[model samples]
Target: MQKTGIANLPLHSGKAPYWLFKRMVALSRAIVELMIIELGREELLRRLSDPYWFQCLGCVLGFDWHSSGVTTTVTGALKEALRGVEHEFGLFIAGGKAKKALQAPQEIINYAEYSGFAPQPFIYASRLSAKVDNVAVQDGFNLYHHTIVFTAEGHWCVIQQGMNETLQTARRYHWLSFTLKSFVEEPHEAVCCDVKIPALNFTAKEAADLRKAATILSCENPEKIIKEMKKIRELSLPERHMVSLSDINPENFYKIFLQTYEKQPSNFESLLEIKGVGAKTLRALALTCELLYGTPLSFKDPARFSFAHGGKDRTPYPVDRTLYDRTIEILKKAIEEAKVERSEKLAALRRLVKITQV
Candidate 1:
């Protein structure tokens, strides 16, 4: 799938109406069933990991295509639809908004026992993905919704959304287990946000030196690292700057400092696994790396989909009602027909080929 640019996702409040959501679940269940039958489970996971395809699927399923709520609502509908059918499809979904997000590890563990697969790695990826987006990518967005979809064979996909309170927008990050080689270096298949901001992204390839230096600082006596941070925090930016050193807190590093000192982290990823080693602490460490060791991290927005679909607020082009209705109708019909025996379903589905072509 072609990776598109980041699209706008306005923070839309309120739940999808009961009537519409029911239809969404029905239609999505059928669509996913057909997809798995035709393309296999791994291919389904790959498409879900593609932000553009996932967004389009949400629209085809009848949610507001450009609304941030689509990320949560679509995943919720899929979880409902996929239940009782996981064994046949080889896919399972875990985690969700708020409290549901906390259930992912245990959910994976349970699935592991049932499927006879190791749970630790899956659990680690689930937690690390959240940590990477929440802390490593220092965008202003705070993640409140997380979803993980995986097959019995261990292929997985994660679709998570974070909200920027000040901007009233949401950013969604996508990760594919099969495509990932390293968790720390540009691991995401795509990141979707409404707009760009000046954010510290320590995971960028340009930040290799900063990552190494931060690892070094984390391995040393946290107190010594703390002292180095103290010196950097003391440095002035310019003669007339709006922000001050007091605005930056080096003290937040104490928890990770103590943890790292007690059990030295062998590498940056290991340091990231420590509890309380979050954004502010990592940010301070990066600053310490730069100030003390002359190694700096990048401040680039890592979002890949920039030229994307129109926003709900009509920033680009308004939503095409005709296209939306046709999409829903096409999916609804194809799903309804797909429930039948092979011969009938094939004849009926071939008639809907024009629908999928779009």
Candidate 2:
């Protein structure tokens, strides 16, 4: 699986008003239905996994284009729009903001049972993607929203968001299962953000050596690693390193180190999957590895992209309800006509081509 991108947006509060939300659901359903019909479900999934396309989608659905709420509101609308017709389209969405994000596993299980497809891989992908973002990549943004959209054939896309309250900004992460590879190594296609702060990116390719060394250190007896941690803490390290002595408390991580010592993970990814291994634990290990092996860890922040139609927040203008409704009706009609009339479908495709050329 490949994580495609991360998008940064200003943190905004409050919900989409009821009047707008209802229209959003209708419009989103029509657009998604048309896409699935014309471009196929996989293509829709691919587009959703692209941060740029997703931002445009939120805007087209009449949400604030550059606000944090775009991630949640747009995805929430999609989930609502897809309700009762998942089997027909072969696409299913799981998870959402806050507590709703925690329900992803069970939702995937339910979808899998209905479709007669194995669910464990999708479940693992969901969990590991979240784990990679939240723990392996210490970007100083704690994730608050998580969503996974999957197809009947088992292809999946993960769209998750994290917030840096201190910074008052939100970052959205995108993942697609189109490519299967190592999760902990250079998984992002791009990261879009206005500001790039130093982050502990263990997933960067530069950190391969650090990952290996950390995995090795993890397998050692907890007492030995604890002693090394204490030694590193006492040393006067260079100021350039992001991990400080205060960040790594050996006592706090002693139990986790013991768990890793027993499990003896074969690789960094395996070590990451272990219970209780989180940002602080990984930081402690990374700091120890850097001091011992002279391997450099990456503290590079990964970030990477827009809008159409009037926005709900009235940036360009308030949501034009009449135009929005008319647009929805046209899309629904086109989809219906395309199903029964070849010429109508061809005409729609031609119009799309002309629009794209513009």
Candidate 3:
């Protein structure tokens, strides 16, 4: 089975101090370079997609292990660390927090043009991953961070985060291309969040019937869907669904429905990719399918942990600058020497294997 899980983190504010952030970038660069050199780019991507490994990486980088900032700050440092050196490692990172997240597609396009690879598949992966977490899974968190990490060979991983203001927590979604079989199924490599509330998880395996029904409904005329949606409003829904009838306004989705109707998507994934199709639209369709077609929905919360060294927030103690710098120096020297010394490369690889085993 694929290694997938969720971690819940406390919502945090403020940024990593410049001094610490600079060190994070340097250390991240050294660690990533060594991983790419020894394990290959694809294996590096696999490790990054693992939530447990990712959280530990943040801790090792001197960030709070349980703080939501780890998701944003770690990826931010990575983007900076890999800048201008992407070609050397054959690894590329795109998208980031807030506004930077929106630039992911264009950034992927630029890299694709430079590397001579098709851009659509990468772009679609980025968008669909975001859509699945943000729309198909209604867990009350709104995504504010999205980053896609890929290689020259086109293998990719997505690390995105969402915030639930009411709960004062953040949930992260991780996706790896190699492990993802279907966007409309259990596609996440891992989802890390603290709390697991009742959520409308249309991507759950149990929701397959609902997904099919929703797709068929989307292809129907808007007028017919509007009528079915209206009829469902008066009926009582399962408490597990956690859908609010008030949130599914039929009139509000008329325009979106018209678009889906014309396109007539052949699958749930295609319908989800349609422009203007969002959480509300999907919820409306889900409710319609349940009430009219007798298809059931899955409210499974797809949420499914480590600290290395001292944390940035000074939890156990303030970051050991001396030790941190020494770690960076060691890794940097190992990477530098590995290029010229076969024995040194073997020693470094052995050390990495031991560390991972721990």
Candidate 4:
């Protein structure tokens, strides 16, 4: 069974201090080496896809276990440390925060061809994963960092994070290639965060009809949406008619339709391929659908605990002792095998003690 838990990752600013960061790199390398040597690349990827395991990894590496920086700093350290060591682990890291993230497709291509595998599918997976989290999920967080690690044999894992500025929190989304059954339906291995807000998740099973309606709307002549925008714009308002499509200028919406009209997107994924389409435009269309077609949309957040061992507090359910013991044993074994200095190993153990305290 998979173990999962949400950790509060408040967005921390500035760089991770050089002293701490260097050790984090060392510790990270040790752990990854241990995972590869003992459990193998597939297991390593599987663990990285688990929110609880990933958080625990960040914690053990001596970062602010609960800081949003863990997602970035830990992945960054692994990227740097893993360089030139790909042969040993059979895993390659690609994509990253901002500029580095934009380099992912090319990075994947470079690595893939070098590793003797085709890059197109990997590239598509990378883009669609980002799109699903950023658009299909409709969560308020804005994704600013993305990191994908794939094995030479093609299994991959994604650990991307988005920031909720108003709340000073970051939500981390995990994806494992083998674990996902559908990109648009419960794609995450886990989504761990500090808070759960009312979010529009078009990708959710609960939003099936809403997604269908929205997709149907997208398939309609883009001209209709444009015409609807004109109607909303022309309608007299009671000082505040609370706008959606009204916020969109007809000319801009017309350009979006022009891009899609030619293709006539058969599905929501196809519609997303249209160049100018984006969240704001999608929101307008979804709202329009609700108003016109009365297709109900769920605002419920899809984030869940779904733990192997329930929360310590046991609100939803009691912790499963056997699974909890197994998780502890595996982590202990990895920590023991990590090839760091004696003092550093002791320090890592001490940090493990701090996990429960945190």
Candidate 5:
């Protein structure tokens, strides 16, 4: 770990200094890329898919936070993301007896405990450092974190930490999951996979409709969704009156479709006029459309991923570039220590440097 002057603060707080936090994030990307390079692509993917590694990496990712306030919030986000994906990627990573445990009705309880999401904050606070590496490599069969419960009914629930706020706190927040997915296709095309959704209470029908909306938004066709929304509007569905197609995914697939068909922007502006239909989604659509159908959209704005902080005297996080370089040098030395052939070492380093784009 490159020193960010962030390790010395209280680890359980929710208010980390902005500069240190930003620096840690930059260092994390470097570390993650380094690990990916060293492990090879196939192995790196496999490890990311593994639950043990995910938890380990997730925890270690949070280790840089000195503020207990920020640490708690960060931990909460990771836990929620893991919980939501448990049925999908999480299940695949666990197999055999581990798989059987997941199949149990009360598996959520078991997995939550196993995932270290229980109410013992004091324990988590104390164990943060030592358990970081252990959680990454331990097999579910060998050592269990929480007990598994197999109930008769299929519905699952976990003994998670209770939220301080009540469900009736805010109406707007109640329906918002806060899990926004950003799609970027540019020089280094990639998706910021599975950001954590915030805690919110939702009505049954609203939740079901939201899921359908998210599915539609995630689809490749914006015109199809527009057609479907228009039909819904025609039907006078109660929910349709309150919702807009923009709430789904805001990609203007119709812009090209319109030019080819009607030679105008009449149908295009209806979807484009929505509040959140900014440059981000437009760029995403442009890239996806071009890659899939060879129809390109115009460049809107410069792409960036930097998150500026307001509290720090504009100095964001201070990345120890010198330390990072030293770390890379040390890794090269490790390759030599392994007694690997010079040609092999050079080849490995070349591949590492290439994948990392370093």
Candidate 6:
């Protein structure tokens, strides 16, 4: 069967009329429960080996904007759900190790390198600010950004200030030393990106425009918004300057915007609806929120296909369609054997069948 394009599919967050949203949530809850009760843990693992099932899990685990997260919190939730279910099915049918079977979720998670966290070099907020000071005072005021994997072991920090090579060199070199060590341990993981987050200078008119947009999104509560705005202002000049300038590209811009607006949903929604908002910005905002304030945002990467293709290695793990089909078949038989009366199981099965239509 031909696979569907992700761009053409309705955004899960944007889908469903307000009235139907409640039903959608209810249906989602039912499906999760049904999977746990009937499919069993091992079976879920076996099924998850299928690319189609992996995508289904991704969609289920996903949130409003971020999709790549699938965080430790969510992973824990999935692990907990597997409780009370039999695991022998995964081992017997899938030929995976019994002891290591429990690690399937993490294994599945590891498949996508760029999707989530792997050790990487990061900049400290203080050092970054200092670098910005040097650059801001320099002739060109040029700032460079990169996402680099640390070659060594140390704390990975997010610089709230700016990135300047001189400042980077002057720092305790702790991060750099750590990065180097990481490289020696594993030569393959050492890499980085020269990512740039352009700065924006928010004009008075632009501020007013943002305010109006916020109002339309129902996020204009004066006192509350003022407090949040204060938090946004708490950032250093370079960071604030970045926000004001709207310096980031479409990818990182949304991340920067969310830093100021995540708590202010009205602002977040309005920004997303604006003409210029794009994938990078959305991801940036989500990551900024998650990494900075420890606030939870969406984890799913909105850009990638749910089926996990498009420059992706389609064969991350060997797919086991036979085990998946057998699991489904077992689930069908279990639905029949469910201690509950046949009528109730039938009704639940009906709901399960309807989920496919979605």
Residues 36-125, candidate 6, lDDT per residue (tens digit)?
456654344334333334434544433222222221112233334333321321211100122233333343333223333332222232
User: What is the per-residue lDDT of model 1 for residues 232-290, given as tens digits with 9 covering 90 to 100?
Assistant: 76686433211235655667667768888788888888889899888777777777777
lDDT of 2 by residue, 1-358 (tens): 2344443477888989999999989998998888987898999988988777888888888888778888899999999999999878888999999999999999999988888988898889889999999999888779999999998787888989888898897777888888647788866544445456788899987888999999999999999889889998788877754466776778888899999999999999899999899888988988888888988889877764322223878988988889988999999999988677767778899999999999
Positional deviation of residue 303's Cα in model 2 after best superposition, in angstroms = 1.2
Q: Identify the runs in model 3 with alpha carbons over 4 angstroms from their true place.
A: 1-8, 236-241, 305-310, 342-358
| Poorest stretch of ten by lDDT in candidate 6 | 184-193
Error of 6 at 230 (Å): 20
- Per residue, candidate 5 scores C-alpha lDDT tens digits across 237-314 of 223221233443423445543332333223222323233433334333333333344442222211111111111222
Question: Whole-model lDDT, candidate 1?
Answer: 0.79
The runs of at least 3 residues in candidate 4 whose Cα sits more than 4 Å from the true structure, single-residue gaps closed, are 1-6, 231-246, 305-358
Report, for all candidates in order, the number of backbone clashes: 5, 5, 8, 0, 11, 43
RMSD to the hidden true structure, all candidates: 6.9, 6.3, 6.1, 11.3, 22.3, 21.8
Scored against the true structure, residue 240 in model 6 reaches a CA lDDT of: 32
Candidate 4 local Cα displacement, residue 201, angstroms: 1.4
TM-score (C-alpha) between model 3 and the true structure: 0.92
Q: What is the C-alpha lDDT profile of model 4 across 169-249, one tens digit per residue?
A: 888888999878877777788877767777777777777777677777776787787777666566663332223444667
Global lDDT of model 6: 0.30
Cα-based lDDT for every prediction: 0.79, 0.84, 0.88, 0.73, 0.29, 0.30
Question: Deviation in angstroms for 134 in model 1?
Answer: 0.4
- The superposed Cα distance between candidate 2 and the true structure at residue 121, in angstroms, equals 0.9
Error of 4 at 2 (Å): 9.1
Ordering by lDDT: 3, 2, 1, 4, 6, 5
Instruction: Name the TM-score of candidate 4.
Output: 0.79
Whose TM-score is higher: candidate 4's or candidate 6's?
4
Ranking of models by TM-score: 3, 2, 1, 4, 5, 6
